[model samples]
Target: MVTRIAKCTCGQLQITVEGEPLGVGVCHCFACQSRTGSVFAALAAFGPGYRVTGRATDYVRTGDQGAKFRFRFCPVCGTNLFHTEEGEDNRSVGVAVGAFADPDFPPPRDSVYDCRRHRWVQLPEGITVYDKDPE
Candidate 1:
């Protein structure tokens, strides 16, 4: 298992990953774009049990599915760091790509919520794009 580390822009926060990410993707839902203050959000999904260090402020809100979504950010620098589903036994964590110390991180393997995707954005072909969560 290769270990990866990321530090927040302010240099006070650090995130470490024990192995390769479980998945990578971009989200285009209106709520996501609005929360991220961008056209879309890039994320690297990981399995449960990874550890994060340093203090982060959490913002919890109901998602499109009515499930609680929690976002963690640096209170001082306002750097968005992590996102997780708020419930017991939810086995996923999303690391914000921008928070990575490496600038050459690869692009996501998918783009989700394409139905709400901005008209000017063109996603890669043949990726697992979804209009919503596959259920």
Candidate 2:
């Protein structure tokens, strides 16, 4: 019954998520870092229980698994809001955790691509981490 609201920087996009997120995690993959323009990317998984309103543009990429990753961002402000993998249906989206603008929303419970993580950046202790993606 937890509902969270996320928005694009310029307010052109808004995503409202109902219920708890399936999971929260951090990614250190090169692609994530580049796409987010940060050392790492934090994501919250919402399973088909969210609604998105407003206009956003999309960019697509091929994942290592050959899955299509479609990124949605606000065209007006160029803020990357959320993304979905191919065949996921409307049932799921991996949202940029920061978009909520809530400092206490939640911390990542998993860390992926640790090998690619920047040396100076330390992850929270005692969660879960994978040298690469989880097996």
Clash pairs detected, candidate 1: none
Worst 10 residues of 2 by lDDT: 83-92
Q: What Cα-based lDDT does every candidate model obtain?
A: 0.81, 0.90
Please tell me which predicted candidate would have the highest lDDT against the true structure: 2
Residue pairs whose backbone atoms clash in candidate 2: 48-91
Write candidate 2's Cα lDDT for 8-87 as tens digits: 98898999988888899999999999999999999999888678999989999987667798899999999999998878
Give the best candidate by TM-score. 2
All candidates: CA RMSD (Å): 1.7, 1.2
Question: What TM-score would each prediction reach against the true structure?
Answer: 0.88, 0.95
lDDT per residue (tens digit) for residues 1-135 in model 1? 877776667867767777788888999988889878999998998787677888888999887777888888888787788888887485688898877756767678888898889899988777788898653
Residue ranges of candidate 2 with Cα displaced over 4 Å: none
TM-score of 2: 0.95
